[model samples]
Target: MRQPGRQTRRPERRIPQSAAELARVHERALAEAAARSAARDSAAPDDPPFLQPRPEIGDSWERLRRLGLDPDAGAAAVHLGPAEIEHRRRASGLDPLLPILRGTLVEQGEQPPLILAIADADGHILWQEGERGLRRSADRIGFFTGARWVEERVGTNGIAAALRAQRPMQVHSAEHYLRSHHSWTCVAAPVHDPGTGRLIGAINLSGPAHSVRPYLLQLTATAAKLAETELRARRLESLHHLRTLAAPMLARVNGPALVVDAAGWTAAAAGLPPPARLRLPAEGWGSTAVHWLPSLGECAIEPLADGWLVRPVRPQDAVPAVPGGSDGPGADTAGPGAGLLAEQAEGARLRLDLHRAGSPELSVRGAAGSWSHALSPRHAELLLLLATERNGLSAAQLADALFGDPARTVTVRAELSRLRRYLGGLLAHRPYRFAESVLVTVAGPEDPYDLLPTSSAPAVRRLRAGLVGGTVRLPGTPPLPGPRPRPGRLPLPPP
Candidate 1:
């Protein structure tokens, strides 16, 4: 106990930076980044000021610029049309978290309201709600539902930063790369798929810069975690229900078999060790779907009470292994074995149409049937890059092609994961490429400029040059433009 008039010490917390302080620090950092750019003779005198940017921020800026964004004249908020927005909302699984997020951040009848916006993993804001007045203010900056807030499209903001970091983040005052956004502050966190651990989207809280406090970041982070917890709970409940249904079915089957839920988790298994996990299509196959599962070749699937019943088409293939290595039954399904089975499938064909307006389209012909899905912008670009490579590229090489940064393997991997889901066994890993037996064809406009207009990769540029110059020739198709190269140096034909 303190005695006399002496005051006792109290714990102190780090104070939130005032708007002016944030401006100063950010200005200095941006000036340093700008100075470095000037030293390299890559920056023009009239370039937009970049406040001191974090490394992630700097990388984002570089990618945006390479994508043809103009810092000085930033993009208008681009929103998906109504139908597309609806499609994303249904798929995002973020709807359940909205009430909790809103209740936490918004008061019953608060005077000045803070905006809560939720964006898909690609940074498209699907939902935004707040006070009437604040909503109007948000509208001016395209913070309304449907606006795209990706760093590449808009610049530094919490939604983009959080998505890139795969964690909660805050962007305040002049920390925003775009001058228009400096007057606002935002905190956001990425939401992930509980089963797949894939980023699904982000949730953000935004308001005037003065309203920001250091604790807001933590608040948003906690909210995000709570949301993830909810997802885990929901998944466990689903698995529980699946198990109850599967128990009855499992007892009836004698051969090695398993019952999997819609998302592909093993609900129950008998006479064999279960694989760690599996993935199901967004929609169920009418009565059944057949796939070449890893290690297990040509398995037949029939709709179960809750999920599906998986059994080997060949009775011999379903025999349980002796719980050990190569000599055992499950040996072939271990580790990279599934991929080996995929490689064995023959006569697979992949058709890509680059001439289609907006985004390119992909259709893969497999043993089941032809399945088609529209490619995202990044997917289209990656496929184009890989299509150009005679030998497949390593992850690092693909990263460099997609982002112009070899270090962005995680981002590359995520995009590839989405692509693989659409194509199934048609895609191969190790050095990522189309399957060996896949016959890939790219249909493009006669003019090279019309080919993959959204892609800025150096390889794409070279492809345009080759097509424009007639230096490249497609097998069984007319040659591209430009003067022919000498016989020995001619570009290799597409495989």
Candidate 2:
């Protein structure tokens, strides 16, 4: 669309000399962009390079436009109740680190004191502390504790944007999609679970637009890192306690065995190579039951003081013997060949219960006996795709399927590798899939829209769309059904 020899000017890449001036520039640029967008006109060809919004800001603005959000609408007023807020605070993993965050961000008492808020992954502000005057101002805009700030609810802002992007983010002045938030500047960084890399919440700093500082983004990011470090350290301490308790228990075991914390981190091992972690049953290991562990095969799991003692069942032997020689809590007494005979009669079967979004379950029945493993959201997605395809999915194919980016094969491979640890021989590599000998079935919600409600993957979105339109059906499985109750826990065989 440009004449020959004329090229679009690129925005400057150098750091701005003054934060206040940069905020002013962004405000002007946003005003012009908003005007052009509202008028349905392309950006003026002769606009100055400084008039262009940053790429992320521009993208957010476009998304808001597509969603038909009103730039002039007052800030969203919905907030979680007090009871819900308290529950989230306790579960956010941030409560214990509140003192650290307050020390790092609040007690420093910078001039023009800033407001610090911590929000859960869902963007509900779980805690807020700062200058009294600033807190009062924030309260007017529904930015206090218990308020939801996700982009979908309140338009573009740092806390919601950072959580959505899973990274550090800054919003200054009119860069906010909602005009109601245009007077403020904020920086936020997402905090993730140290063990599972799941997003837990975000650390946010906000103040008047005039208070915008180049260092605030880094400060927030540093606070988030510190919180994660503390969380990891706490987990390590727990593992240490578990190791101390497990040492004596595993010493008395007869064969290959290990002890692991609830999150599956190995604390100790005997007669085997200790994997750093093991995938345990989703609902957690029952104190008196034998479970099928992918890495260890059939395992008799005994509850230790702070961990579990896992002993592998030998194929030649009917049961894994307990330390006391009595068929006790950690003993498998299914009798010789009981599991093998069941496998021979029924073969291997995999049932994916995906009717519930956040609680996906995978049940595997075979020579090792039947057990259900709770699935992470990502794992559930991978299994759904594999179950539907039947022919399997290469890393590249799966990368494209999940992320809409084929170049993300490395991420796909890493996740698949973790899954293989939980699946063992039941899963095959090359093009990843369930082994040919396994029969896979998927149970889904009757309302197609309910399928993986939390997933934003392109493939899943498309499948949901097709299903709602009656153009698609859950392939390689029986017809979708209404919400079904989860099966009761399998009764442990009598001791």
Candidate 3:
């Protein structure tokens, strides 16, 4: 807890002081006032104070002079009153707005088409996914940052309509209500959590009507897909994080979890009540929460919002013992020859499982808590052989220990080379060397790694629950039927 005035370690960044100029451009107060004055009404409608032109602009030079601004320095800034200063503090950019607007649409050397930028309701970039030059343009337009695309504020542009309609739409060229935007076309699509019907956001592809392609509509969908894909992947990562952290806790409490990702898929899961998977239908699991099965052992799950949770199962639920090392049939019968190789086989199993899902990672550590980044089964064997023997294994001795056949001489040497390079890379500070034809182990009193990286403390629990022994139930579409099952073979359509 922070004391009332104490600073937190997560320091806040300083707000930029250039916001005054940006406010003047985006709000267009001067232009509106000019139009109002021209309309024969001396009194203008109330305008946001910050939106009024800065007195420091070209015409305001003399006024700036009174404020002690040095014209020669190019460092003189807009002088604002207290209220104006506070309002500017809340404005978006530190850059001059006109230059930003021009930079967004116009080209400069090495600065391409993505000059312009635009943002959505949640202050996120939506149309910025277009060509780089246009993106640059939008950026200068104040469309990229602190933009709110919610319906009432911006009307039916791609971002606003998607949220309001809760469906995808394309607000192409000439469709814009704001006459100022008659030059550009936009295509946008809404992303949904199919299970919950919650609209995450929309992706929009926009560019100059003359330069952009009609098929940017397809590009819009593609961008939405990419976003959804990323959401799903992040879910999986969160699940893995939960799995590792929840291990110690899950042992203490019994509970099942359903891990959801931003894209509606249940990315990773563990301790799901058996009855839920077996008794309930397959389609039953996607979006909503169901009643808990106390028989599975009641456990409370804490949700780590970016889609991860770890909780205990019901206390009454029975959890079978986890296998010590062996799994799969044919567990015995390795004979005296393979008796020492069991851990190597177990390590191999783990490696294969990892590769099938994603990356391959295997670790073997001594009781002293030292880790060896063992890749091949042979590597595990050599490490184990080194640890067990009272007498060190020489080049010839290791060859005998690894493969009894002396003809396998060069083969053992190759495996040793691999192991040496791997461990050396991982523990670079404390070097491991391969000298002569022999393998040597270096003992250095160094502490192993203690913490794993994660976003924050709250997310740690859910991330750990994801990785270990969890099943992910992904959304699926029914397969197309084969030509209506050959009309005659299936009964003819009933009238």
* Best model number under TM-score: 2
> Which 10-residue window in model 2 sums to the lowest lDDT?
1-10
Q: Is candidate 2 or candidate 3 better by lDDT?
A: 2
Q: lDDT, candidate 3, residue 114? A: 31
- Predicted structure with the largest lDDT when compared to the true one: 2
Instruction: Output the TM-score of candidate 3.
Output: 0.32
**Which should have the higher TM-score, number 2 or number 3?**
2
CA lDDT of each prediction against the hidden true structure: 0.63, 0.67, 0.34
Candidate 3 ranges beyond 4 A from true positions: 1-144, 191-198, 252-495
Q: What is the lDDT of residue 15 in candidate 1?
A: 53
lDDT of 2 by residue, 78-121 (tens): 78999999999988888998999999888886456799999987
Q: Predict model 2's lDDT versus the native.
A: 0.67
Per-residue lDDT of model 3, residues 87-192, tens digit only: 4333422122223323323334442233233333242442333355665665543345335544233332556544333334455433443334435555555553
Off by over 4 Å in 1: 1-52, 80-87, 107-113, 279-290, 295-298, 313-495
Ranking of predictions according to lDDT: 2, 1, 3
Tell me model 3's lDDT, rounded to 2 decimals.
Answer: 0.34
TM-score of each: 0.56, 0.64, 0.32
Backbone Cα, N, C clashes tallied per candidate: 11, 1, 49
